[model samples]
Target: MIGKHLFSVEAKHEFVRLPHFGPFLTATAAGQAVDSLLARFDGLSIRMHVLASNQPDGVEAKEQECAYQLECACSEKSPLSVVEPLARAGDLPCAEEALRIANDHGVKACEIGYLKVDEGFLLLHVHMVTADLQKAMTATRWRRRELLGRPEKGEVVIMTTPIPMLANS
Candidate 1:
C-alpha cells in the first residue's frame, strides 16, 4: 500500500473579482460580488482524479491527433493565473480499457492548487496532493528550483506514515 502523506503546498495571493458567465447565470453586480469571494483565495485549485496508464482505446485515425492528451488525469477547480507555471495535465478517459490500465498501474486521484501575491503576480501559494507523493514532491522541489534558477536545499514534510503490508499467503 502507498503512504498517506499526500504531499501538498499552498500560497496566498491578492485577488480581484473578474467577470464570469455560467450556463444559467450572467455577469451582474451580485455575480461580481460572488466572484470577489475568489479574491479570498490566493490562487486556483486543481485535483487529479484519475491517472491513466494508457490512452483510450478505439480512437479512430482521424481522432488520433486529438487523442494526444495528458491532463485528463487532472481536474481544475479555478481559472489559472497568467503567471502560474503548472497547467492542466488533462483528464483520464472514462473508457473501460483506460480504467483497467489505470487500475493496473495503481493510479489514484490527486489534487493541486496555486497561490500568487498581489504584487506583480508573484506566486504566494501552490499545493499538490497525490497518492504518488514522491512524484508530487519532486515536482514541487523542481518548481522551487526553477523559481530560484539554481539548486537549493529543501525538504518535503511527510504528514502521514505508511503502514507495512504483510506478505500475502
Candidate 2:
C-alpha cells in the first residue's frame, strides 16, 4: 500500500473541461510517448492531474469535486513548477493533445501533483480510474527500470544489514 505521507504536494488545477486520450494505447507505445514527452522537461519526474468540476445541476448548483487521473506519466521527483512549463510549452504535442482531449470532453481544469520529498516512489490507485492510467503508469515504471536498473529475481537472497527507515527522521 502507498503510504499517505508519500503525497506531500497538493497541486492546484485550473481547468474548464475534461480531457481524454485517443484510442487505447499499447504499453510500449505509451512508454515511448511518455519518454518522448519527458525529454521536454529534461527527464524530470512528476505527477499531473486534469480535472473537470462537476457541471451545474439542481437549483442550488452545488459544486462537486471530481477526481480524474489524466492519462500521463509521472515520477516521485521534480516539482509542479518544473513540470508545468513543459506542459505549457507551445511546441509540445502531448500538451496540445491534452488540451484537445479536454476540450472534446468539456473539462473544467487541470491539476499537476508533484513530489515534495525524496522517497521511493509508489503507484497510486490509477488502476481504479481508467485504462489510460495503466498505460501511463506502465510507461513510467518501465522508464524507471531503464534508468535505475531493476532487481533480479533469485531463489535465495541474503539481507546483510538492517532495514533502513523510509520516513524522515
Give per-candidate clash totals: 22, 12
Write one digit per residue (lDDT tens) for candidate 2, span 81-134.
Answer: 111111222221245554563454343224211122234221111111222323
Stretches of candidate 1 exceeding 4 Å from the true structure: 1-21, 29-34, 42-127, 130-169
How many clashes (backbone atoms < 3 Å, residues ≥3 apart in a chain or on different chains) does model 1 have?
Answer: 22
Best by lDDT: 1
Error of 1 at 98 (Å): 11
Local distance difference test scores for all models: 0.28, 0.25
For model 2, what is the alpha-carbon lDDT of residue 55? 27
lDDT of 1 by residue, 1-169 (tens): 2122111112222221122211111123223333433343335342212222233343243133212111111113322221222222233223453334334433321222222324322111223434443454455555455557434322222111111111110
lDDT assessment of candidate 2:
0.25
RMSD of 1: 18.9
Model 1: worst 10 consecutive residues (lDDT sum): 160-169
